[model samples]
Target: MNQPWSGRKLHFVGIGGIGMSGLAKVARSLGAEVTGSDRAQGGHDARNVPAGATVVFSTAIGADNPERTTGAPELHRADLLAELTQLKPTIAVSGTHGKTTTTSMLVHAMPGESYLVGGEVRSTGTNADWHEDSAWLIVEADESDRSLLKLHPTIAVVTNAELDHHTTYASSRDVDDTFAQFLARARDAVVAPDLTRLRADAHVFGEYDGPLAVPGAHNRKNAAAALTAIEIAQGTAELARELLATFEGAGRRFEVVGTANGATVVDDYAHHPTEVRATIEAARSQHPPRVIALFQPHLFSRTQREARAFGEALAGADMAVLLDVYPARERQEDYPGVSGLLVAEHAYDARPGMPVIWAKTHATARAYLQRALQEGDLLLTMGAGDVNAIGRDLVAHSEPPGR
Candidate 1:
């Protein structure tokens, strides 16, 4: 069957974004002429855009963007997924956390299954893939903008639920209710036992005792969910477990960027408090020595809502460095008194014995980390924002130990 997007010229406004880039790659793979632009300098550029292409923009792109004024028909990323789900047997993974990891695992277990994941699968080197003749399609259903509701998957996987995206959800209950609605629409689902809204055919799974390449108990739970989905798809769980044991994990999910001064530098996308705690615990399990964490809060709204919780999570680290808030799409002026300092203050109050340093800028934070990081330590750069760059830069600039 010919792909519906074949012969179409597509332009993505913010192609550098994780989700947008995934869609762009899928479109290109389907034989569409694809080009893109991002405000950031290094991503897609104007030179690559074809003449008279259909422009697609995410919510982050402003009306004033040149591509937005091109008068091309606009399509949201979610709209594309909705159209695809209508045509394929979709398995959508939706949750407040572990969605990417679970989706990647399913893709690994079932070879040749088309997928649209939010992060790059280290093994595959791309986030999204197109298999024109495949019967199944897997995706990371995002709940941040309530976009997961648009997908109608044959099977859904909800890892766990928590209150996030303060702008979309009114309360924790609202978040849970939204997830329940998403699951209700799916033909079948595999969820964590704690989710508790399973259908007759739906399955609930707990931790797996089998060996896994990824660290942490949470990953064990993710592996269990993936195994259940594989079983439902009529695949062998034993084979899946063997494949999972060799999985290198998705990018930015406990990715080991490099090593410096005898300490391993890890980059992780963990913004929520629950995620933060899990990532830190994973680092401790691997390193066993001092775990030095440098966290840059992702959004102002999230920081304002979960400052105390974030502080408590950071306290688990042997030493914590709080960088300035990334603020993604929000203006700093709109959310006053919401910054790294707020988290530092709360963490100090909660765990006075553990040291928390508030470094308001990247320069200060980098200097502090260089001086503080020593042998037998794990340096974890954690957040949902661009803080991952700091870890890469630190490794790139540092000399080998004993230089």
Candidate 2:
């Protein structure tokens, strides 16, 4: 378990992003020099970006203010399409939801350190690490516009197939077809536990005899895929199950902040339909008292695609709080078609147990929760964006039971 790669150079396109930054950190740990450019800079951009890696600014930088970037990497972002076209490296991870978490898991679990593009590496306390002369270059392959198909990973792991990036794919089948193409590029494709056919030509990795510690059944599938990928990468499945069982899971992936006033506050980054369903089901598996779900929809397009699904998922909670959509990278103009209120209305009709409540902002949502939630309730603030902040604030302000 000596550090795999101990010296090299790596660069990232969107280093400020959580997934991107996590990759940078892992690369640095492998002993590679790291540098990155952010469209806009934030606290995540300017602070603790490894010791030697330079921060470049990109032209995609918007007016968001907090994450401002210098103009250094402006040309780089402008010409990234051409630049990445030429910069060849080793190993790239391609997928949507589990890109960061699973990439990080593979980086930590697998042998032969790698240079990750947008994966979390714990050794360097950052994302996008650089290792020396390593055969592995782990990257999160985004399926937007079939971009991931460009990558050539010796071993590829597909966590799950879902309809994402509506701005790109026309339909769910298109997304799957694109993924099928990506799988075609890999020498060996690591598919989920239940997938039987898996595009025929590619080799599918099998599950070992072991139980994963990760909460949800979805994670169990993720674990199986990761294990398969590791087996392909390192040419050994030895101790893989042991490593998987010890995994505590990534940050904000159903992370429990603390308990308060006889209630438990759990935070998770579950924005998509499949993710939301898995997270809530995991909460229910624990059989917690009165599950209180505080959900903030992530994107306008996503909300529209899965609003009905979202409603059905939230209905599982004993009490649910629905906040306005968090439009992080998208614009408000796109959201009028798919509002959080619409999602709530649909979910209300579907579930007969606890009613889904709507709030315009976090303040109103938190206020509603403060009044409604009592002892023995599990308040789960779940989303991919900033929704976890509400759960943190709630835990901070609430008093212990009988205090």
Regions more than 4 Å wrong, model 1: 42-52, 198-201
Candidate 2 lDDT over 1-403, as tens digits, reads: 5554446445565777665465456545545577765656533344433444333333334534232342222232323322332333434455667665676666656545644434234434555554455666666666655767666666666776777778788887887788778777777776654443456655554444476666776666566667777667767767776677776666677777887667888888788777777788988888887888889888888888788899888887877788888886688785666778877886787786567788868899877776676787888888877888877787788876766
Residue lDDT tens for model 1, 1-403: 5767788898888888889888888888777888887878555444545687877877677676666675667888898778778878899999999999999988887778899998989888889888888889989999998889999888888999988888999998898888888888888889899787544456898998887889999999999998998888765687888889888899999999998777789999999999999999998889558999899999999999899999999999998999999988899999988888998888887789798899888999888887777777899999988898888888888877776
Instruction: List TM-scores for all candidates, in order.
Output: 0.95, 0.79
Model 2 CA lDDT for position 270: 81
**Model 2: number of backbone collisions:** 30
lDDT of 1: 0.86
For TM-score, the strongest prediction is 1
Give candidate 2 regions above 4 Å deviation: 1-15, 20-91, 115-125, 133-135, 193-198, 205-209
Local accuracy by lDDT, each model: 0.86, 0.66
Candidate 2 Cα RMSD after full superposition onto the native fold (Å) = 5.4
